[model samples]
Target chain A: MSQANEFWVVAEYKDGELQEVTLEMLGEARKLADKAGSLVGAVLMGEGVAALADPLAHYGADRVLLLDDALLAQYTTDAYTTALAELIQEQAPSLVLIGATANGKDLAPRLAARLRAGLATNCMTIKLGEGGALQMTRLDYGAQFQRTMVCSSTGTQLATIQPGVIGVGKPDTTRQAELTTVEVKLDPNKIRTKALGYLKPDPEKIDLTEADIIVSGGRGAGGPDRWPAIEELAAALGAAVGGSRVAMDLGLIPWKRMIGISGKSVAPKLYVAAGISGASHHTGGIRGAKLVIAINNDPAAPIFQSADLKVVADLREVLPATAKRLRDMAVSDEQGGQQ
Target chain B: MRIVVCAKHVLDTSIPFEIDEESKGLVEDGLVYILNPADRCAVEEAVRLKERQGSGEVIVMTLGPAPAQEVLRECLTLGADRALHLLDRAFDDSDAYSTGFALAHAIEPLECDLIFCGSQSLDEGCSQVGAVIAESLDLPQVSAVTQLELGATQGSVSLQRKLDRGGREVIECSLPAVLTIEAGINEPRYPSLPMFMEALHKEIQVVDLDALGVRSQEVGRRGALTKHIGLGPIRPRTKITYTPESDIDPIEALRLMMSGQTAPSGQQSGDILKGEPDYLAQQIIRFLQQNGMTPEANV
Candidate 1:
């Protein structure tokens, strides 16, 4: 058994449910906690968040500390950090794991600075090494190299893990955990910026991070044309649609849907590359995909090197045909089920 | 108003990198260095802000070895009014946290109203320094800022921050805040020949760890929160099996092509079919039929 007795995972809730990354963190945290002989604690902060303790427990949390208040209905840096840092100081867990979301990124650094703790950001893999030290692997230099970091022994080890990189454990309905409410006093004066509101993109489109499969187009797709061919394949496969930097730069796709070092890093179950040359920049984003299938006219495209399946054909013709085949396959599966 | 922009000189990434056997880091000898791409955007934003004000100075500040002076020089040529280099051997092993601590100390005494930094360094992509510095200096920070609007007269700045999942957040913060600029915010103007020549002779003020009032113990490996335990190439994807286009029926060939499963062992590359388009399409259909995936397969 390890010397540390506590492991903490910060829970993030949005749109009235626990974010996917929170569950993933709990899943990984449970393993590390078992290794260290430590109890896994979930720190949930937000208004009306006490009810989230059950889901966290189902994901393997042994205890839940909820800091629910009206002031925290929306995330403001000062309030959340103050409450969280205070709880961390009190609990003094050996390690804290946070999801590398926008709010999580902003909060982790501020909390680390306030607590003077060592922080590893954007870690893809984490393990508890000998002597209870947290070992973390993260991508650096624009995904050119992976660096493994070991936290110092002096203070609490903190890390922000990227979303979609880690797998979530199956929920256990019979799991039980203790929930405690902690009161926090937030000074409204400390909040320098008020979240006036939020602006969203087209809601009909699936989020890249949440999608299991992705169909990405590049400059080779020849000017987007609303990316109908790519969309057809995505619709057929039930995958999200994405684009490369060139396609995004040309205003053919939204910049937020870009897959590369600078944009969102996604790890889908299956990735379809259409008309992309597979430059290191674009390929790096697809590194975590379980399987890659490339469709490009250029046989020399670098993307072919990384793909498990290659179709060297013009996407305009191949995409429509492929989509039809997949649709037909689905129909046959239904018919077989009926028989 | 004085705007301070943080710049970094990084090894050019387009060229292949060779690791130094002795240090386990990039080999410095014979390697080309350039201003980090995103830092160039930060400099551009600072220069644009200076030009808009028409009276303020934009100072470029950086922390690195002597070779990094080239980055500061480039900023000068690009229209910065002055340069500051925090140079010290002790910082060679510093991580993002310690570096930010030293930088915050260095900038605390300077007269500044706003600070800008590239959201990340291309060499490390840690993205911790700017936020850490902001925390140390007790200032609000907004990162990944793509659109910036400065209300100079109102002592506030409103900006649009990019999100990874497809949206933007509009945030407004008071002046004297830190903003980490992302790429593509503005097209960086190229330095003209005359401007380049004029900036060649400008002096960059150099300060060491002691001069900046930062103790040597507070930097380098000793002060670092995290230590690099290992560095190596990223693991490549699993090998693929290639099927030759001429060996089988086109439909059968295409079915095997669409399947993402690994091919028989010992096949390093996948099949390459060089055939007529009509034939290839038929092969795909045949493969689908063999797999019982087509409606006809049910018959």
Candidate 2:
């Protein structure tokens, strides 16, 4: 178990850049590493990954495990899992955390199975338990209940942290890390899946996950007919528009725009819930927000309880006015600067 | 072509759930159970493929108690030709690893050309069962498939997988492969009237650990390498403090909401002209044009 004391984080890369979630994981891993009396390390695998080691070090990784190879460049389940499994056995980190992205979700389980370790997925928080074990708490039964889990056996404790759930810590830009290069042996016959091509989504599309402010509408927003006012407010705030599961279920918005446990998890600085009843299932998605404000006619709505500020007013009356006022304020500010 | 669709009955994710006091787990009381959303998508994809090929049989299989028949019935109603219910009291407490072993055993006798399952069940969302099942059977598997199309040959299929970093990848695999369907693969079809009635009377073959020659010691809670130690409530504190009133009435309310100290600032403020669709549309169109954009043609 002494080998397990070191903290390891898997860094995910996209378009020659480190994904934000990778930084978030490193930020959390730094805390765990400090508590475990060890150093934080990262497993960097992919094409052109050597450039990522410096940024990882800047983000507080004491060491970077670099697996650089063309076969390792593109993510294939068989290839990635085989390589990671071998690394786990060799390094034997006490705690391994992966971002609960699509790749992480796919890879974590296979690695856990190979190591015969316990896994907790989509965890909200992770900390060192008594005796230096990992304690993980995740929303269960659709965010209605929370379950705390720990690895009962020896070896590595594995968890996939949900994106936008943890805070991105301050990176120490002056830190230096040791980059250890390793070779992963791959069997051609074992590689059954092959990547044919990559498709990129349209850049103009709004990704709420990256939005600094989100304007979400619910059933009380009436219908698709009322979306213009909501869009106006979103435009005024330079925010992304989101919808509750009820709105998505009722076809008010596309399911991709739904924000909840089944959908995307977002952690914008400001979150505005309009016409939303504030169901626990839905609130779980926004709990990571720096601030939450709820607007609904029913003052007794459950969402108000979770909100930092509540407006007992109709959304139809308030949204456009707020948009106009914010616009006016922006214009005045610009004019004053010119004067 | 023979297709095997693995399904699991899970608590509907849309509703609030409680933990059962007796079981020390999720409370099933008043909770509606349905075919896991991902699994439904998988079954629907298989049904569509079979329909396209014009000659294939879809078999639905689940490992749970009799109540899980409801999930199998859902698949049958959606056009599965037959169903297999791997029912046994002993299988109740199986973890992902044990579940994988049991499923692999059950799938061995069927000799399926393709096995499909949801990417992950909503309850545990472990996202490992399909891959583990593939490992147990020593077959190739792909997870989180957003799109699937049959290739030039009968035994090959092309797939588009949802990648973690906001992109998709196209992959090709031969037949006798396992594929887990992601959400938004295709809209799952509703059960037809006649199929629903027929599903009620269908004789779903029940298999046990012994029937599949799986040792009792290899499954259930005992075989599970991990167990639940405790559960906790996630309670985030919400403290509200109103701003001091020093402004006029109209802007005062707005100021109160945006003060940051009192309320989180993004809550929906209603459109000023409430309940007037044409007026709202006119306002929206004007706003768009003012911003050098035209209203969407359809809208």
Candidate 3:
């Protein structure tokens, strides 16, 4: 079943930085290839993004296939797909991994269709299953259940993993990867979509899907006056702040922090739901979190069902105590370490 | 002008469910279904586009079981001119790739100018069907679309696509393109009483896999490039509501409810605290510490 005996990670380079998911994919690819016996390849596409090859190798790419050109700088569906499809066909790698980010989601399916490959999207986990099959698991149907999928195709297997599902590995800066520069050929006239511009949230905000830890405020947490307590806990825990739909609608938090069925689905290491009743829509987004603790006054809160730890009390009291304890521990640890 | 809106029939996941061990699928007993949320937005967008243009037809389509026709009927009441139901058991358990393959073949003969689909389906959450259809038909596609406006010149459009973290990107695409709509683009209109009654009389065009020249083996389990090999751990989601019967002693039931014994949920229980705030806070810290989430790990 192995055609080229290589696992590829399509590097996502945006805003002049290598996206964190790329490093995660590289790390996961390294682990997979080490166990399965294959070379790990990374594809970096952007003008002057060749510098990213060093970090890709340090994280785990054995070979970096660089596609650097001005035409490939701004992402147009046609330009990126044509360049990537051609490379994958040339290499015929057994597996292709991509980040389930905004542009990556738009690009992977189109590339898979062009290459006649099978693709799994929003995958939470990818590993070699029985008979060395490429097994993938993802949330299904409003996050009601978890369904495992495997590529039964004879063609290349492709998957886009959700951001933050896997953390990055320690970089071995001593490593160096074999770099192969691929000549990009794309006709501007054939590009169907023109990227006019972009609208990004404030730079101070963290993307919920990419955040490793999050503390989300709910309507049950009272009004805007109580939002700061949630933020303080998030700051202590080094987590991003999220807002339930009702809280966002009430203007307790910004729209970008919204998490639920309609907003971004987040996969954090730990999630703290402060005073949230755990509506189905909100729970749908947080299902991917590794650990969840729901603090609310209502014992019958629906959020408790999904939570690993439940505290049925006023968050106004619980949050302050938790944050203070965490901070105290950090300060004591720092003093002890300095001695 | 003709616009094709593709919708999916999915389980009403708000309802509690249990997975069947044998089939590795959901238990179908006493289940209700609804249109995929994003796809409903696609339907609504199609109607709104036609309404703005003043003349055109909205052809809504879906590939599902016979009961899925309910969604199509629902679409008709929302201003869809016709419904195309691709009905056949041969198409069951089809993966995203084969599902798109069958839909592409069925759509080829229609030769519509524009195609609309949900950015992703609620069932599989695969955002690939529209792109696959576009690739099969050699048409351009714009996905995660929030807003679309016709261009000054024909054969072009100005659209805004959704990005991560509430970001949006403006883009331009040519006509005859497949557009996958995002949710929250618009509030779907509710049908008037007159329109609801009129939609009941409209006949849906039901076509089987054979009619579209699609072989049974090319789809479903036979041709699916992917297989749902296993089920992952299901978070036990038993509702907490306890309704007492008339036979039960009222005092006993009340005691059962208050003693934290109502609906034990089969041995699965999280830590429920009912103590002083300071004591509860200590419990929270201990739990976090046991989980290896110490303050030192907060870097």
Local distance difference test scores for all models:
0.79, 0.76, 0.83
Interface DockQ of candidate 1? 0.24
User: Could you give candidate 2's per-residue lDDT for residues B1-299 as a string of tens digits?
Assistant: 88999999998878876666666676656878888998989889889989998998999999887899888888888888888888787887877767777887899889998899898888777777787777777677778998999866677889888875346788987778889899778999977788789877776788877787887877777566556666646753222222233233766566655753233332223222233434443454344344323212101
Worst 10 residues of 2 chain B by lDDT: B290-299
**Each prediction's DockQ against the real complex:** 0.24, 0.24, 0.28
Best candidate according to lDDT:
3
Per-model TM-score versus the true fold: 0.74, 0.73, 0.73
* DockQ, computed on Cα atoms, for candidate 2: 0.24
Off by over 4 Å in 3: A1-3, A202-339, B234-299
| C-alpha positional error of residue B241 in candidate 1 after TM-score superposition, expressed in Å | 23
Q: Residue B283's C-alpha lDDT in candidate 3?
A: 81
Candidate 1 recovers a fraction of native contacts equal to: 0.42
User: In terms of docking quality, how is candidate 3 classified?
Assistant: acceptable
**How closely does chain A match the true chain A in each prediction, as TM-score?**
0.66, 0.66, 0.65
Candidate 2 yields a Cα-based lDDT of 0.76
- Identify the candidate with maximal DockQ: 3
